[model samples]
Target: MPEQDDAEREFDLKWADNAERKEPSARARMLAARWKENPPEPQPFRADPDPAGPRRSSWISTVIVLGSVAAIILLLGYANFRAPY
Candidate 1:
């Protein structure tokens, strides 16, 4: 048990020393320095125009309007021809 403990302690110390000796790589230091010196610029926000805005009447709407007018005219003609109460 004592031997195992001693070995573990030595390993831990060696690992800590190695970690302390290691320096940040050049790329990592460059990125960190760049971020510190020039932070990211804020992006401008934009809204998309409404897709349904100001559209011309489609063929379907025109056909429906014409059909409604014709139906009203037919109804009026039938009512005129009927006997008066």
Candidate 2:
């Protein structure tokens, strides 16, 4: 029984060795060949600007305008509702 187990282990190792010796897939070989023939080219940095120029009114400007209008309307309402005391 021990000899049989030893033979089976040896057979499994042989099979593993054969599998490891197999060649890579066709796609892998092609990729390797391409890399060897012509390595990748280094790319340069690129910068692109927005097609449209700066906004007419920035967020801060819009916020300020909206706040000023709201305050003016509230002040007018308060003045009109005040009781004469």
Global lDDT of each candidate: 0.84, 0.83
Q: Which one is best on lDDT?
A: 1
> Runs in model 1 with CA error above 4 Å?
1-48, 53-57
Candidate 1 lDDT over residue span 1-85, tens digit each: 4456888899998888888467889999998999898987665566455555787669879999999999999999999889596
Native-structure RMSD, model 1:
16.4
lDDT of 2 by residue, 8-65 (tens): 8999988888884678899999999998999877655663444577767588898999
* Each model's total of backbone clashes: 0, 0
Model 2 score (lDDT): 0.83
Model 1 global lDDT (CA atoms, 0 to 1): 0.84
Quote the lDDT for 50 in model 2.
42
TM of each candidate vs. truth: 0.35, 0.31
Pairs that collide in candidate 1 are none
